[model samples]
Target: MTKDRSVYIRHIYDCIGWIKEYVQEGKEAFLQDRKTQDAVIRNLEVIGQAVKDLGTDSLTASHPETPWPQIAATRNFLAHQYLGVDLTLIWNIVEQHLPKIEQQIIAISNDEGIDLNAPNTPELP
Candidate 1:
């Protein structure tokens, strides 16, 4: 893969990792608590940053299965305006959308011959 593609894939993997972490712990419970909403929004911001850094063009052109623009926009909203962040919507996206997107990333990586088990991979932006 080209350097840019490799970077994007790494970003996707990082997002997947974050999602897994959120799910594994009881972090999902935060979605229902208004008090923990800020933390959830913060994590979503990270997810969005990774998506934006991955870029829409290459992702759409190559990995059409992923919704790059929507992901980036979500990230933008979370980062730029925390007050506007909707907890319910964020919760739904985390519970419903992220897992599927994660699977697609893994599939694409395997198809492109990426080694997920490789050591010291660069952090995705």
Candidate 2:
């Protein structure tokens, strides 16, 4: 059986949202704020874990080119040694990679005929 695509979509949304808030003051602020780094990194971890939990079929059928494994591996790397996490790399991942992920997820949801604006944006745990 396959997991709901919305769950993973929500994860992507969440990660993106957190990054948005973190970067409100711009890249300079994000680079200087330890708290934002912690929050963003954890959300990135969730995005990866959620992607891993998604069914292989859904991913292969729709978002086939996503680097799901690499995303998950990044989560593991962050979790084990967060003290050494790279700000530039995290910024790159959040600013560059996540929007693409979010776009792909939205495309998949639209293809499935799911209403993205439905009143059920689950809060990140």
Tell me the deviation in Å of residue 92 in model 2: 0.9
User: Which candidate wins on TM-score?
Assistant: 2
Q: Quote the lDDT for 91 in model 1.
A: 71
Per-model lDDT: 0.69, 0.76
TM-score of predicted structure 1: 0.71
Model 1: per-residue lDDT, tens digit, 5-96?
55666666775676556555554576555655665566667667766776778678978877888887887777777657666677788778
Can you list the residue pairs that collide in candidate 1? none
Worst 10 residues of 2 by lDDT: 116-125
Which residue pairs in candidate 2 collide? Answer: none
Task: Please provide, for model 2 over 2-56, each residue's C-alpha lDDT reduced to its tens digit, 9 standing for 90 to 100.
Answer: 5567767666666677677878787888888888888888888887777778754
